[model samples]
Target: MAGTAAVVSFGTASAQTAPGPAGTAAGTTITNTAQASYTVNGVQQSATSNVATFVVDLKANLTVAPLGGNTPVSIGETDAVLKFTVTNNTNGTQDFILSPIQSLLGGVFAGDNFDVDNIRIIVDSDGDNLYTAADTATYINELPADQTRTVFIVANVPAEQAASLATVTLVAQIAAGGDVTRQGDALVSNGLAANRDGVVDVVFADNDSGFGDLAFNGYGRATLAYEITTRNVDLSIAKSSTVISDPVSGITLPKAIPGAIVRYCLIVRNATTLTPARNVNLTDLIPANTTYEANSITVGGIALGDECVLDGLPLSDAGGTVLPVSGITGSYDATARQVRVTIPTVTSLLPVAASFRVKIN
Candidate 1:
């Protein structure tokens, strides 16, 4: 008498135990067995099926998410940093290839008008969630399952960029993990009907992350925006009039009456900004029934108490007068009765004042 051994395959039932983000670990061996008792052996004969085992395949998955909504940046800014988080959801350790892509006109990030310059991808080496000179690793290395790493998209804004908004997407591609010193090759899915014996295969189970990235591609992506703030110089004009002398009340308490000399001051101030205001031109018209005071126009005057001290250089009434020290130009038109002053630049540190005198008719 001899005992017979039989083997039954349950590929469908065993596939449920494959490795995944939350399932069994990759390279783990799973075994199953089947038992049968035949009627011919009613006296008590049973046969045990052989073991059917297969190694759990690797499931590559990851997710990328922006740390915040929008990264506000100013024009001509350099080394601007945008943050993101990359999580390894695979059942085993993995490496991620990081890349930054500028978005097109529309899609997940609507109204994307410009592209950033000098774009680069960098991993947070110190786990501080901030970009520093010490953080220089470009790709994620040996990131364990269920662990997250911070990443940065560093770029520079163009000096003459006119667009107000720019969008960038960070894409992380799953790669093999093992070596800690160098990056590994990118993972490719092994499409097979049955799991290979004693071998670890790969399967992509990631979800779509917009920007035309589809699921099951071992790629995860997230989008961030760079919003340009209004950093141009803010120019403010303040005008004040002071009577120099009057016929009835001379110098002590001047009044704006006939035959009185009056000075009109226009102060142009530039608020603090990234850049200074240039080509600042100011114009003033003589009041009705008033005569222009010859050679009365002063440029770059300083404010003393409430009156514009004529500390600035005087201009010739004949027109086309340029101040040598301040580079300020002034002109007067007798026919039009107008005074014009042109300043090359207005900065935040000081205010430029243009004052002219007119006499009552």
Candidate 2:
């Protein structure tokens, strides 16, 4: 324990004291000179022997790198991971308690999206991005000096969650068991400075002992985000038609032929599992050989007198000329010769149907 040991440099009584922060780390080596006596040539002769040497051990330094960016999450998603990193700046092994706090309520970024539920912290033991319960750890243990560890803050996103931004902040504190800046500083060295922010990093002797010891340096912080976005919409369109009659043969038969009335049905459904598809619009092209029957368009099984006629009700003060209805509305592009069905909204389970009859030439 560097934290609990006296860090003064080793030296002879009259030697100038070595300069350093303290704890375990010191100068490269300390050497001592001693005189040896030998009966040389019958006269007692004293000779200086080789120097005794001691080598300096490791030094402690801890620094946590700042987080780079925010995590993007989609609505109806689960188990999204927010990543961060922790580094051991010391020269020896260290242990750090890991803590992740969700942005508090009423806070700036925390104000939106409220909170990300079921938050869990995980350490990447194998250097892989995957997070497994077997790899979960509450604190960083035995992290070698100059080494770094990636951390994950995983959470479950609600399926119906709105499009919003969420976030979480992480903090790392040394939990003792590393190199110390000063002999006595290590006394309370575990979790160095106990979450010190304003306190100076260097500790000095009251009487100017010349050796300014750096306190156990174990404090770091970072913040990440969950950039929640709109869930993907699973939309599908189905087109089908039925023949009613033909004018050439005057055979009111249900077979397709020239001059036959073909009723085309366009079904637009939001096949999503948990979200609503918005502003859904369907488009179809009318062939030059066929002509669109007037006042033949209907939406949701109701006859539509005009484009804006939603279930026989005028969609707006402008009337049904091009109004929205029953979460559905439509328009016919006379110039482009295309029929466009505009759906105001569509749910996961409720599908909307629009139909119109086209007469073949």
Q: Model 1: per-residue lDDT, tens digit, 110-178?
A: 456678899999899989899999998999999998788999999988766576777776878999999
TM-score of each: 0.57, 0.44
Q: How accurate is candidate 2 locally (lDDT)?
A: 0.56
In model 1, residue pairs whose N, Cα or C atoms come closer than 3 Å (at least 3 residues apart or on different chains), thus clashing, are none
Flag regions of model 1 displaced more than 4 Å.
1-21, 33-49, 103-109, 233-361
Candidate 2's C-alpha runs over 4 A off are 1-60, 66-68, 103-113, 132-134, 159-163, 176-187, 190-217, 231-234, 237-361
Q: Relative to the true structure, how large is the alpha-carbon lDDT of every model?
A: 0.76, 0.56
**Residue 183 CA displacement from its true place in model 1, Å:** 0.8
Tens-digit lDDT track for model 2 on 165-241? 66566656654454444112231232333433323233212111111223343444555566655567778777777
Candidate 2: residue 331 Cα off by (Å): 38
Lowest lDDT 10-residue stretch of candidate 2: 7-16
The residue-level lDDT of candidate 1 at 22 comes to 42
